[model samples]
Target: MAASSEEFSVNANEAIRISLVQPGPNNRLITKHEFHPKFTYPIVGEAEQIFGYKGLEVELLFAAHDLRPHLQCSYVKKFDTVGTTSALDLNKTFGNFLPPTAFQQGFESEVLDDSKAAEWTPPGVCVKKYTRGGENFEVWAGSLLDMPMRTLVDNIQIFIVFFIEGGQFINLEEVDWTLDRWRVYLTYQKASKTPTPNASPYLFVGYATTYRFYKFQKPPKDHIPISFPPTETITPNTLPSRVRISQFLITPPYQSSGHGSALYQAIYDQVMADPTVLELTVEDPSEEFDKLRDMNDFDNLEPQFKAINLKIDTSPFASMDRGRLKRVPTARLLPLDQLQAIRSKNKIAGRQFARMVEMYLLAQIP
Candidate 1:
């Protein structure tokens, strides 16, 4: 008796698993995960099916600290080709989605090397270090012009596309000046247990990236043009710009805690601290991300909102006809000048500020 064609096909998402593994004495247990990719169409096909394989399992392991990648595939059995029908070449299939180094024969051993992986730390300056739920973590940031940072992102960029919906790759090949305008924020935590010899005791948490785009400022009507000497230094980092968080993710294991909020607040604090930064923004934020931003914004503005007392005046509503009022007098209900002042001082965009105002006003209801 022979089985049907459906018997030979497997779901690519369920079959593929990605794990962030730590350096051990040896690749003893082959860290296991049955995690699914958010999307598998890019790798296999629209159907997201792998044909000619039965009980397929693929593990894509990355170094816990540095994110060096290694991919391994196995299955109960691969069906033999029947003329035009052939079993998929799993490794070759995945190669399209991973960096070429991931397929290098000796890459797994190198990635598991604790001596180097332990020493590897998050790039850039440590912007914040705090603990939540008794777990310690730190967030560091670096410019994209950095070689090590660029290499780090290159290794993990594929995961961004895989985990984040509608995510795309960052063009590291951009010119130096342009690259300098980009920034990456990485979070890490020290190992809670013992460490290997001469190895780092830190593990990777997750990361976020930001791009600083130039912000134009209108000059005063009475201002005169002034020319600066060619010798004077001017760099993108020093220009008045709006920083937009391009991609953000807190790996599965570390999520559901306050880490995402902390990372976001860290970025906000860092960007706001920069005299050159005009404002902070996010590019195509997901719904989950929007909620996170809203939480942080609400908390951050609470004190400021309190000092000025952001209470909505109800005088306009008091005299409204019960059933005939066609419009709400927004101007009379809220102080536009006060809100605008707060928005400018806080460097929040108009739309976001308006949303926050709505949330604040609603909170005042008895």
Candidate 2:
């Protein structure tokens, strides 16, 4: 018999809150086709089951002062509506799909108190891995520190302890889009009580709303009106659903370190212990990412770690029922030389700005 594994939970004594938020105007929405809704598919089998049947497995690790580590993963979920097949009701269910670039608009933030300064809190903490509600969120270390290379491992420990101990996970709202899960806002308060409406007097560090998706064990009966089809009538297999990494990211300052590998290993071990998982899937394969495989990056991490693309959909499955499946495609990485050429093509300032945006958007190590 296998050893019984222990489940971990955050300290209840700590007030770290995880809540849901509403979507805002600045966010973008996009429609995806041929993907599955996550709620319909349960990852840890039935209630009390140790592992998930059809969802994602997330792990985190903390390493050196780097704050950001390279992230790696095999599959994640894709949620959106299709023309007819596996369709999800938009207005009735999910409000709208946001585009990737919608939140690119940077918002100014103000420190609530003097203690929030850099000396008290490290600046520009690199975001090596961030995933929540289908949004690939990322932040760079440069933004955390006025002067780069100022981050220290000790400071990160202090920050993490403070956040974990305090109810200030909301502070993450400053740079993270997923903070929307919690209806909490982290903004700078203006001194003037009669501040002009919508004026630029104070900074909007973070809003209290965000767009997101949720998977349910079963569609509620009462909530299902006659106009809408009942979810229970739909068989589990036929239930419009897809497996996804609802939230997956390598903890900052801990990426490339053994943390990513350790986290993946834990996930693999947990999944293998469960019997419900079918064949896992990973979308678009990237040559750059594949190189990581050659380095034994994930060896001993999982039982069967395979990498393929759309071409292999027809192949017979060995672990199809619980492991083998499909994946979304990965975006291609441009050559450094070519990227430099494009950056230098425009004015020096333009090039610099473009680089900043690129680094902010794509520098996620994982």
Candidate 3:
């Protein structure tokens, strides 16, 4: 019986068919692509396996534009209980990951109604629109405090667990001030043929999120401290802030398609254009994202670096400093003040600026 039971087990990631679905002709849903989840341990269990089922397949579908979701669980057979063993409770297991609405009987109908997708322009303002490979794309961004943006993120939070290893959901009950720190950006493909014939052309591609944290500014050397009232309506935006790229995910189909670069540049452009933002930083980024950042950051700064003739001064004793001192101070070896001005002007974090310098120096070689 133990050996027989082994046949009923299935790997959670493999058994789940996750898709970004869109409407085809006549308002019929069609899968854009089917991809397996990168991680399911958060949704299922640490073991990431399901037992007491055969031919198990779980369908987790998201409406491409709005990310409204639908879940359908099906299997060929369930093992008979011997003592206490039985089929895995699919609903109870997935309920933790999906919104409660996904399990309701009529929930699937909400997504099947292609009318919503047709009329859906991405929520919030269209911050950017560009053409790539002859297809038009738009980037829409809004404060999460807004109901539409909040609702949109609530619908899509399930992707964080599927794609990011240790991703966790954002708490929805936070106060307004905390919610104001969050900004969500969604990327969509503008209608090529209408989303449905004669429908709005927006189609979901990928998204990123960001938040602002206080960036302390040091006062002048001769400045004196002054006390102020405890509460005088000092909003978070009033002070200098570091624009942090918190969560960035370009969906599977859009990855490696230059969409990542476009989205990243858009964020950087937005941050730099804002006078209140001190510098831009990223929360812990994945290996892939690090590469993306490095490539784009260099591209943005390279022209300025060349225009200013930025390069390392290899000659430490060119001014006879060896005879007067034990070592060359870093400030003298490189023009620190000038580099700081450039970095500040560009709103790049310090360490990122240093890395960009290295990349600049390497490019100067040969």
Candidate 4:
């Protein structure tokens, strides 16, 4: 019976008929599969409705494979005059819900004449200015207390709302500029090679805000305290020992063109030049910004670490007492003193510096 069954097979005509039939869309074999797809979550307030929006609904769209998440805003509004309600696409109606000034077209035009360029000096003034890609760009940095710097920041702060998620407008007027802790860096571009006689010469490109904080130090026991009466106002230069980059942003059009990198490097150079700045740090950073920082810092520190022959010591441990052998000596495994000296010279924050050191050590392994 087994031999007879083996001999029995479908004819060529029957096989051709079977092969002609194709699976339907709903068939498992024909359907496309996705491990994870896009999804949305409703945003609700205390009343289970969107806040500050009447008859409007908002949902946050997220996807596992997407780099940037977006918000879907919709609204249903009834007009008394028309006596009808219509659904509205918030994105189209509000034009991305950004202020008009956020657009490049809204900026005024300026030409970079020789006399105008001379006004921007270096060192204590605007750190650097140059022409790139047929555009005149300048980086001006000053303390927040400066009236002109504060005014410039106020004009462009609205862009933060468009670039940053859940970002709100900052009211520079309410800030106590007298503290002298905040520093602003502005990037301006020459809007056109030829400008009308009265038109402004430059357009706003991007800006970053940095904070200088006091670094507390332990006073020697033998040192005597000198008490002084508090004055009406203290000067801005009492102490600036540590610096933190708080907010960094580049306009949509200017992003990915190396402007952001240039701004960051300029700020880094300025901080490094200051002898008082013991460490350079950043406030809570987004993943994207963190990646940018890692690339920049790694590039800057790689050569230094390599020159010092920084590598993991995987050799056999020296003979020691039983008690000391039981525990892992992390410091002994790596050159802690040399790393500390390099970190101090570079003025890198402790946590970031450690990450770079680990990467360098791993690279040296092979």
Candidate 5:
């Protein structure tokens, strides 16, 4: 009996063991795993009693990495009579009960020739493509207004809940396209030289969402406010000054493959190209995301900061004269103007810029 239960346990112990182990050299935690169900039983009564009549088979689909793993399950009930067996409708029976991330029934890979395959390309305009670890990937950027983008997101957004804790789906229909503030970035893995036949040439790997808002620019002191007449039209460019990344996700299969960094860098490059964008920021970044952002931003800003000779001034302590011994001028110790210039040029937010500056200064102190 114990052995039978063990077989039906879906190797829950193994999952726990793996979750306990440290991350690989890449420093990425393996947070998700797919499992196959090996046994079926009823909610009540013994297994044989349920098999004698109508019964439900519960399949545990995914195990999330945690102190004690949480499992996501799917159900399949016997639809036919006791003697006769028929095909089980996994979607019709268990669609709503299963996690949205587990619903991939309609997303079967569609085969297409080269010409027809181009249509499968993500909605946004192609940004760039590069190779990493011998794997080729492309980045695309487009506004939410694009019809293809809207359609694709409707299908892919379901996976957000699985990858992002506490993530919720957004209503595409209710979105006000006239605002033109939403943008999506998608990354796809390009097929290799010997690609599988009938398989999609480009496999969707990950996506990110960003919203642009007007940066508050102070009005000139001499400028006076004027109420415009109803007939007058204000053609404000509405230049986006602040762009905040709302959601960022890379599929479990593709995580730790450098796709996240690629997607982020592509978006950062786009922000830099826009003259109106004063800063790039994230909305409620998770711990993992914060680390990723810090690594990328530090790598990007270090060279520029070094080129300008940006460093902490400890010389104030060097000249410990009686008149200057009253108190340490913390603000005056650092080159504020140079730091501000670097911050502006890099488009990093104030708090984030300060943290990076502090790290750089501390490194110089030793």
Candidate 6:
């Protein structure tokens, strides 16, 4: 039966309080324990309760260590406020060392009692006591001094569990806590709960990079090739110029939601706000040109490129329709819109040609 506080207190004093227990060969294994200073036990009552016998024959077992005879010890129970589990009073048998600074750091000692050695519990209270052994008569107040020397030797066990395996002592500061430094992680939060926070209007966060657009004084009149080298035939005229996104990830959690289009519009708006830029480059219908090819309208690719502002200053040749070869001069220039109308008369051919052109312009080249 669990003893009452008063009864346990009376019985606690009869037994010598030990904080540490050492067991096995070489005394390598040790258990750390705490005791309440005020708690003590009545010898006869404790023994009878332990054996579960009334007025029966009982004998105490003894052993020897370091030329000193080992005396019978009691299995004292300790308590903690946080939980109902009781710890053992093995402080004496183990003699484990607890650093004063560690105790002062208010680790386990954060729950110590002010009095009663046998009544000690986890978060055990600190107490001052005189050294028991001769020639080392000194007073100390920390739990480190209340245990046995062999117990201190077995601290390797405590080290393995509490630190190495249990991870009770972890360095949380070392963790990379921020998912995105300037950005934030976006969860598909329920619309009913709370509105999500918006990203900075000036900055954009992309899947892999961050950016902000820089305004230009004079935007080109037609499609501006954001890609390097304005002209394909490079003679150094298209000096390496830099173009940047207004702000990457300006709208996080964009998903397929119209937010992407809105963000794009915002970028356009920002550029438009600066009256100097009359035109800005954006993907156009030529993107669909890939699905058209292999028909009379196969030649529509070149014209589509021009219709979308990707003006082609190249030549076009006419194929022979009669046995008498007709020569059509090359280097012909035609507005893309005009050519598209001409090709549309042949529906199937027009579509096939459009697809071929779209693929060439939209698709990255090798």
Q: Which candidate is the best by TM-score?
A: 3
Runs in model 2 deviating more than 4 A are: 1-255, 293-298, 301-366
Least well predicted 10-residue stretch by lDDT in candidate 4: 13-22
Q: Write the per-residue lDDT of candidate 4 for residues 55-106, one digit (tens) a residue.
A: 4444322111100123344445422221132323334433443333323231
lDDT of 3 by residue, 100-182 (tens): 76777764456666455566788789999999888999999999888888888887887888888787677666546553788
TM-score of each candidate?
Answer: 0.86, 0.20, 0.90, 0.61, 0.67, 0.20
Arrange candidates by lDDT, highest first: which order?
Answer: 3, 1, 5, 4, 6, 2
90-156 per-residue lDDT for model 6 (tens digits): 3321233222222223222221221232221212121211221221111111122223322321222
Window of ten residues with lowest summed lDDT in model 2: 28-37
Per-residue lDDT of candidate 1, residues 1-366 (tens digit):
666777889998898888876545545323422255777776778888899988998878877677778888889998878446899888788766677878778765565554565456777989999987787899999987787887789888877767787887786655455437778999888756634454456677889998877776666889875853332133467777788899999877777898899999999998778888878888999999999999999898878887888787877777888774548767777788887788877888778888898898788788
lDDT of 2 at 40: 14
**Model 5: per-residue lDDT, tens digit, 133-179?**
88888998998888777666655554554456556566675877767
What lDDT does candidate 1 reach at residue 5?
A: 70
- Regions of model 5 farther than 4 Å from truth: 1-119, 193-198, 220-237, 317-330
lDDT of 2 at 147: 31
Which ranges in model 3 have alpha carbons more than 4 Å from their true place? Answer: 4-6, 80-86, 112-116, 175-179, 198-200, 224-235, 318-326
Worst 10 residues of 3 by lDDT: 227-236
Candidate 6: minimum summed lDDT over ten consecutive residues — where?
A: 59-68
Total backbone clashes of model 1?
1
In order, how many clashes per candidate?
1, 52, 0, 1, 0, 61
